[model samples]
Target: MVHIQHKVKAFIKLGSFLKEYCEYSKKPIDLVGINGSNLAQFHEKVTLATHKNGWFSQENINFSLLQWSELLTENNLDEWLGNYNLAANNYKTVAIIMAGNIPLVGFHDFLSVILTGNSALIKQSSNDDVLLPFLADYLIQSDPSFKDNILFTEGKLENYDAVIATGSNNTARYFEHYLGKKPNIIRKNRNSIAVLTGNESTDELHALGEDIFQYYGLGCRSVSKIFVPVGYNFDTFFKAIYSYHPIIHRNKYANNYDYNKAVYLMSEFKIFDNEFLILKEDEGYASPIATLFYEFYSDKTALLEKLKQDEEKLQCVVSDWPEMKTVAFGSTQKPSLADYADGLDTVDFLLKT
Candidate 1:
C-alpha cells in the first residue's frame, strides 16, 4: 500500500512545479528539474484545450492553474487531510464522470480518490481531455506508485466499486438509470446566486463582477442570478460591473449576447441592456452568457427560506449578508478543499463504502 505521507509529498512536489509554472508575472518557464520534460511535452495540450473549446479562454485556464497551485501546498494539503484518518487497507477503484464546462472542474474528485489511496478510473470530458492526463503523469513522476493507481477509460466504466458523476440535468437521468445500484454520488445541474439588499458599497458591487464574469459565467459556482429587494435601483449595479464590459468583445460571448438579445427583443420581453450584458427579471436560476437573471423580493425572510428549500438546485449563494452561509462577493470560484461538490464528502463516502 502507498503510504499517506508518500502521497502527500508527491502532491507537494506537484504543487511546487505548478507554482513555478503558473508564475504569469515572469516569462514562461521551461520544463525544469526532474519532471520538467514530461510536463514540457504537454504544453501542446493547453493549446489544444483552448482551440477545441471556444469558451475555454486562456485567462480562465491560467486562473485554474493558479487556484490549484494555491490549493496543493503543504500547508493547505495537510489542513484538508487532517480532517480524516485516511485509512488505506481496502483498495478500490473510484470512477469519475467529470464535467467540461470549466477547466480542471473534475480535479477535486480525482484528488480525493488518490489522497484516500484508491485507484482513480477517470473519464474526462472531451472538452477538457488534455490537461488532466498530463497532470496524472506528473503525479506518477512525483511518486511512481501512482502509475498503477491512475487510469483513464474511454469506454464505459467497469469493475469500479463506486462512482462520482457530474453532468447536466438531462444526462443525470441516464446516469441514475445505469449507475444507481452502485455506491455513487450523482450530481445534476445546480446554479449559484447572490442576494442584494441595495446597501452594498461601490467596491463590494464591483468585486461581485468577478463572481459573475469569471470563466465567462460557465462554472456551477458562477453567479448566474441575483435576488434584489423591492425598489432596488440597478443603475449602481450596472455601473459597478462596467469594468468587465470588455468581455463582450470575445466572439463566442458576443455571438451569445447578440443572439439572445435579438430573441428577447423580438419576444417583446422587458430587459435592461448596456450593450455588453442584459439584466432580465427572471425567476429562473440559470442565465445564459451575457445575461443576468434577477428577481425582486418583498423581504429577505421569504428569500432566505426559498433559498434554503431549494438548496439542492443551488451550488452556492454569493452575498455580503451576515445572516446565512454566504461566500464573499468575489470568492465563489475559489472554494477550499472542504467544499465538496453537491455537499457530499468524497473522502467519507470512499472510506465507508
Candidate 2:
C-alpha cells in the first residue's frame, strides 16, 4: 500500500500545478513541472471542458482550482486529518457519483476515498467532466503508486463495496433503491439561503450579492432565497448588489430572466423586476436562475427555530447573526474542507467503513 505521506505529497504537488494552470490559463506563462511532467495537459483540459459544457466557464473552473490549490496544502491537510486516525483495517472500493452543477464538485469525495487508502471508482458528471481526470492524472504522475488506486468510469458502477452519490431529489429515489444496501452517503437537492436583519452594512449586502449570483446560483451552496423582516426595503439591497449587474449581459442568464419575467407578468404575479435579478415573494427554498425568493420573517427567534427544524433541506444559512450555525455573507460557497455536504463527514465515513 502507498504510504499516506506519499499521497499527501502527490496532492500537494497537484495543487502547485493547479495554481500555475490558473495563472497560465488567464495569460500564458512559463510552463512548470509536476514530477518532471509539464502541465500543458491542464490547459488542454480547461479548453475541452468549457466547450463540452458551456456552464463550466473558465472563470468558474479557475475559481475551483484556486480554492483547491489553497486547500491541498500540508498544514490544512494535517489539521483536517488531525481529528481522525486514518488507519484502514479494511479498505473498500468506493464509487463516487458526481454532480456537475459547479466545476469539480466531487473532488472532495474523490480526495477522501484515496486519502483513506480506499480505491476510488469515479463517474464524472457529463456537465463538468474534464478537470478531475487531469487531476487524477497529475496524482498518478506525482506518484506512480496512484495508478492502481484511482479509476474513472463511464458505465454502470459495479463491484463497489460502498457508494457516495449526489443528485436531485428524484434521482436520489433511484439511488436509494439500488445502493441502499451498501454503506453509502447519498445526497439530494439542497440550497443555501440568507437571512436579513434590515440593518446590515453596505459591505455585508454586497457580500450577500456574491452569495446570490456566483456560479449563477447553480451550486447548492449558492444562496437562492433570502429571509427579511416585515416591510423591509429592498432598495438598499438592490443598490448594494449593483456591482453584479453585468450578469444580465450573458445570453443564457438573460434568456432565463426574460422568460421567467414574462411568465410572471402573463400570470399576473407581482414581482420586483430588477434588470439583472427578480425578487418574488415565495415560500420555497429553491429559486430559479436570475430570480431570488424572499420570505418575510417577523421574529428572529421563530425563524431560527424553523430553520433548525428544516435544516436537512439547507446546504448553508448565510446571515450576520453570529449566534446561529450560519455562515457569514458571501461565504456559503467558500466552505473549508471540513464543511461536508449534507453535514456528513466523508473522510470519517470512509475510514470507518
Candidate 3:
C-alpha cells in the first residue's frame, strides 16, 4: 500500500508533465520509444479521420477533440486524481476488457488504472485498437517509467487483483462465469434516455440533438430514446435538429439510414416524417439507425413507473425536468471526470489489491 501511494504520486507528476507538453506544443506527443515516422503517421491518421466528413461528422469531430483535450489537461486530471483516496491501496495489475462503442471510450479506464498505481493488462476491443497505444506512446515519451506499467495483450489474464470488463448483456454472462471469483467491475449494455417536459426552449432542444446524434447513435452514452409529451409537435423538434442533416449525408451513415428506412417501410411500420427527421414510436430504447428514438407519454408518473421497471439496463438519463439527476443534456455531451459507474470509482477499482 505504501508503495502504491508513491507510484500514484509519480503518475500524477507524469500526468502533469504530459499535459504541459500537449498544451505548449498543440501536437499530441506520440513520439517515444517507437519510431518518429510512425508517430507522424498516427497523428496524421487522427487529423485526417477527424477532419474528413466521410469518416466522421463535423459535430462528432469537434466533440471528440473536446473530450481528448479534457482528458489531457492538467486541471481536469488533477481534479480526477484528487477524487480518489489511494493511501492504503495496492494492486499489481488490473485487467481491462474494454468496449469500443465510441472513439476512445476505453481511455478513461486506462487513465484511472495507471494513475492509481496499477499496471494495466489490456485486452483491446477490435473496434478501438488505435487509441490506447497512441496515448501510451505519449506517456512513455513524457516519462520512461510508464513503459513498465502498461501492457497490451491478447493473451489470457489471470491472477490479477481486479478486473474491469465492459460488454453487452450476453457477454456479461461469460464475464461472470470466467471472472466471478475475482473482484471485478463488469459493465453490461446500457442505453441513455432523455426526458423532456413541455417547458424546453428551442436552444435547449437543439443542443439535445448533439447528444443524440454526435457519434451517429453508436455510442452507449448517446441518447437512444426521448420521453416527450404525447401531444408534442414533430415539426418543432425536427427543425431544431435539422442542422445535422449533412451528417446523415455521409455514405456510411446514409447506408444505415437507407437500410433502416427500408426496414421500417417493409414492415409497414407507422412513421411520421418531415424534411429533417423521422418520428416513430417504439418500445425499445435502442435504434438500428442514426435516428432519434422516442416514446411519448401522457403522464410523468406513468413514465417514471416505466423507467423504474428497466432501471438496471439504463446508464444515464437526461432531462429538462429536474427530478432525474443522472440525466444531463446539451453542454454535457462530454462528461466530467466525476461520473462514476456501477456505484464505484474506476481508480478505486484499480487500486484495490
lDDT of 3: 0.70
Q: What is the C-alpha RMSD of each candidate to the true structure, in Å?
A: 1.7, 1.6, 4.2
What is candidate 1's lDDT per residue for 136-209, written digit by digit as tens?
88888778888988999999899999899999999999999999989999999999999998999998899889
Q: Which residue pairs come into collision in candidate 1?
A: none
| TM-scores, one per candidate | 0.96, 0.96, 0.85
Off by more than 4 A, model 3:
1-39, 45-62
User: Native-vs-model 2 lDDT?
Assistant: 0.88
lDDT sort, best first: 2, 1, 3
Scored against the true structure, residue 176 in model 2 reaches a CA lDDT of 96
What's the residue-level lDDT of 143 in candidate 1?
81
Minimal lDDT window, size 10, model 3: 16-25
Q: Report how far off residue 216 is in candidate 2 (Å).
A: 0.8
The per-candidate count of clashes, in order, stands at 0, 0, 1
